[model samples]
Target: MDTRERYAAYAERIAGVSPSYAAWARSLDDGVVSVLDEVPESKRQPELLFAVARRLGADPADPGALRALVQEARPALLGALTSATVQANDPRRLAPVVPLFAALAARVGRPLGLVDAGAAAGLCSIPDRVTLDYVVGARSEVVRMHTASVEPGLHLVAEASGAVPTPAAEPIEVRARVALDPNPIDLAGPGAFDRLVEAVPPEATDRTALMREAARATLAAPPVRIRGTLPGDLDRALEALPDDVVPVVLTTGTLVYVPGADRQRFVDRVRERGVHWIALERTGILSGVAATLPDDVDPADPDAFATASLDGVALAVSDPFGVCVRWLADPNL
Candidate 1:
């Protein structure tokens, strides 16, 4: 009936479906729990919450039950909240979601050039070169933004199996005049730092460990060149692009934070530029049953009553967690 009761029911139902998820639920720290607790009841849509919870290993069969459990556990969960902040405040959380964008980019046969609106610490500024190996079957040139002595520019190259060839011999190109931002964000609080640490998957290897470490160091000692700019200011950045360029705009879990007017203006700016693609992931509130339930509830004639829109369009609509894969192709070219 109440919010706390609803969350408790949700958790219980999830534990019932997949016992493994119970372990993950228990493993979540107070900081993480705090995030779940603060989700406003008005914005809390059962289906999206269920889908995300399921993806986090909650039972899929009875998502409503999980919703009830979480609702009931609200106070205890709130007590666990170390800080009142969104999880995206930490950049490492965005790592897992990057591949979805990359795969989508590759699917449409377009090379991606990312524009991070918040661009905090540039965590998502440059695509992690390692992800390309698994999805795109290649490596990207790592843009060195930390050092002023080293030329700042984009490198375009392919790596052989488990080997890093000399930059001179490879297809690497250096632009001496390109601007570089060395300063990122100063995330000194324990809550933010711990989240970054916990986000690293257990399967991470020596290279991933090194990369994460480097990212941490960069955050600690950001380059003086680093600067913060609003999403609307990107119009100049877009206009400066060369005539031959086809840019793909991407923001992961960042768009929703922007005010509606800014978001609309940013979209219009991109559209006016005739940009090739715009990819983003945003959260939307919706009811769990209404969003996921089958169109035809009639058990007697299942096939005849089945939904038509599911297959017609790649309508992978989940209520709370909106995983969007859309692109606006340049109509003129």
Candidate 2:
């Protein structure tokens, strides 16, 4: 099968494995069917398309009807295709978009400090200066790297491995810098190994799980405490910051996990601060939030994160495998 066909098959298999994913696949398939009627006959391929459509309750066996439906729903299908591409290439899942925030900070003459709201193991927290090199086949390439620095007084506390004893309170007034010397370790073996494992056809050994454990071992190490900010209660912790300090709220893979209302509230709070909010979150969550924005509101504005203010905020979407990066900055700011 060709690349697109393989991807379609992978999507189908993934849908079968997870119910949540099945729902997403069904939604997309339904959309595809609804717009299929407008699609040209040359583009119609009921067998391949129906395999995908069936996941969303379409009759895959009815090739004739499916083709007719596809043609009738071409416009919506086209839109769905665009959305899928965007969703597939979301920057929140990747690390390349992290540096754009630093560049923006330099442009705005503001101090660059990152707060990863849903920082899972803080793997993407590495400074922009450190290049994450990955080997694909014979070529060694730099996937993405940034030279940006974490803000002063930034503390990251996660569940420790051994019995180090959790602290009573978060650490305060500490200067934490990204370590580049150790080099970004992959321990997961090959480049794109995680993605490969994830895209593997059915019956593939639980390689993804194994890779996760290995990544956890290599990536999740000692938690750092700086400036008294703990992982939990980010908003409350940030509010206590000294008046002089300007904060940039950032997160990736954490926003989608949060409820829609809660995410909006968090964004609103970030805007209230009148500082930069760099969010590297899943495209799905971003799209959902963007849909709710007022028609007059321009998401590209620096104050877009806030409900009623000019506070600067920027969003960068990352891909699911954490590879590609797409940035959305406030043009007005």
Candidate 3:
């Protein structure tokens, strides 16, 4: 897709999620998109452009903010665009998968060895330590996985489907946590936590607050951060873990960053290692899993959002950030 089509599609993608972003994306005139052309196609994504502008002090919801930023801070914007990518490391992203993690943890009956393939700031790495709140049709309940060791942690609230309500399970133990990313956000470094918050749509004030809370919890016990990207770095990350853990690799919106073939390779490697793989990615990205999606879901439509799969089985389709989850198959319990 050209710059015009790309932004137009982005407008539709986030329309329901962020009205401000939707409006701003659709309002991008030729000149503004041309400024986006200055960066490579991958970096030209609406999220990157808008986020970079916001980081540079542009009002996020303002329709023509990018144009103004380009006029005032072109050099700084371009310099930032040279390296910055959208960081969807929101710890709240774990909400939808909280149930899936519970089922997996119960089945394994061992301490977890977590390897997050694209763990931006390692925020979502503490899956077992966080508290999960599931909103069913008419009732809301909390399912917590935290042991006595970790401090009060992330409280993830997600509306769930009727088929799979919150599970009552034993607390999951995290023996070792490792993260692999080409550029992992150093949450403890100067201004590092703010960088992660920049990706949250400016209209989302609630998420911003939750992010600050999550950051504090993550800083308390950060992951053993490694430097690498998906599929290629899975083994190296696994090798860093202790031998007693039930290894699990997590890929949340990370597969889209790699090529099509690498996606399959990553799945293959996970199976070969016999470690459980939990994927929350775009629908069609995984051919086998996509085929298993209910007929009503369409991989081509961004509105289908994302699919959450466990070990190649289609588990549920949910909001990209896991705010709303409709269980397709039982949590594999």
Candidate 4:
């Protein structure tokens, strides 16, 4: 699709997920899209557009307000586009998958030492602090729903059809949490914090609230954030962990930014270390994992937001932002 078509489709998507943001997106004239040309290759990403909009103080409910900002603040928009990297990572997404991580830790029967790859602020590293309400069979002849509260004030509710393996809800013992990033966000820095918040759509109030709470929780006792890129620095980061702790590597929506070759090499490096691995990335982004999936799964389907993989096997398909989740009937559990 061309840039116009891509943004149009993104507008349609936002209409479904967030009507307020959709108004702002649809109001973007072709001239506005053209202004995005100031940046080399970011006009196609919804995240960048929304982040720029938020930074401009565009209220999601008011499209005319955003349009006015675009017309008046061209320099500011262009500057943000040129200077800001796409650090649109959210910890709320990890809330739905917390059980999956706990399940993996239980299977290993060891204390976890988390190593979050592409962890911008290390928010995704602390899944142990969020509560999840999972419904395996929703509105079926036999529906099963269970709520597990691990931490205060953070909850993710999800549902799936058919029979599924019950994920263990017991909190995984995490002794150390390490975050790896090319440039780690300093929680104390207002600029860095604002960038993180602006990356998410303003219409997602639930997400925004959860983010602030999670950010505070993470900052209370910050994780060890290593300043380095992935694959190249994976070994060094892993080696930095205490010898007694069992390393569990996590990558969520991070591998999409990595080259396919490097993604595979990163996976290999994790396995070579004999550590438990959990990854949540867009479908078909990782060739090895995509090839492992059944032929029935189609990346072209808009509903197929991402595939959750355990050690390289595709287990469940989930919404990109973790609003919903559906586990495979037989995930090789």
Model number with the top TM-score: 3
TM-score of 2: 0.40
Sort all candidates by TM-score, best to worst: 3, 4, 2, 1
Candidate 4 lDDT, tens digit per residue, 1-333? Answer: 666676677777767768776676677676677767666653346677677777777776677865677688878887776766667668756744575677776777877888888898877877776665665543533232223344443555666543355655466677788889887887878676776777677667777777787777678657887988778999878877798888888889888667667878898888788887888888988877888777777876655678877778777777667656666643325
Give the distance in Å from residue 307's predicted Cα in candidate 4 to where it truly belongs.
0.7
Error of 4 at 117 (Å): 1.6
Per-prediction TM-score: 0.37, 0.40, 0.89, 0.84
Residues forming the 10-long window of minimal summed lDDT in candidate 4: 140-149
Local error of candidate 4 at 235, Å?
A: 2.7
Q: Judge candidate 2 against the unseen true structure and give its global Cα lDDT, from 0 to 1.
A: 0.36
Better of 2 and 3 by lDDT: 3
**Per-residue CA lDDT of candidate 1, range 169-245, in tens?**
11111111111121224445455443333322223343245445545544533322224333545654444444443
Who wins the lDDT comparison?
Answer: 3
Report how far residue 104 has shifted in candidate 2, in Å. Answer: 3.2
Model 1 vs. true fold: TM: 0.37
Each model's total of backbone clashes: 32, 37, 0, 0
Give Cα-based local distance difference scores for all models: 0.35, 0.36, 0.79, 0.72
Which digits, one per residue and each the tens of the lDDT, describe model 2 over residues 1-333?
Answer: 433343354355455444333333343344444454444432333223433333233443342443445556555445443322100111223233334443454455534444544443344443332222222222433332332132221111111111111111211111222211111223344653332232222232443443343334324332232222223355553554445444555554445445567667666666665655555443335554455344655433322322211122323332334433233432223
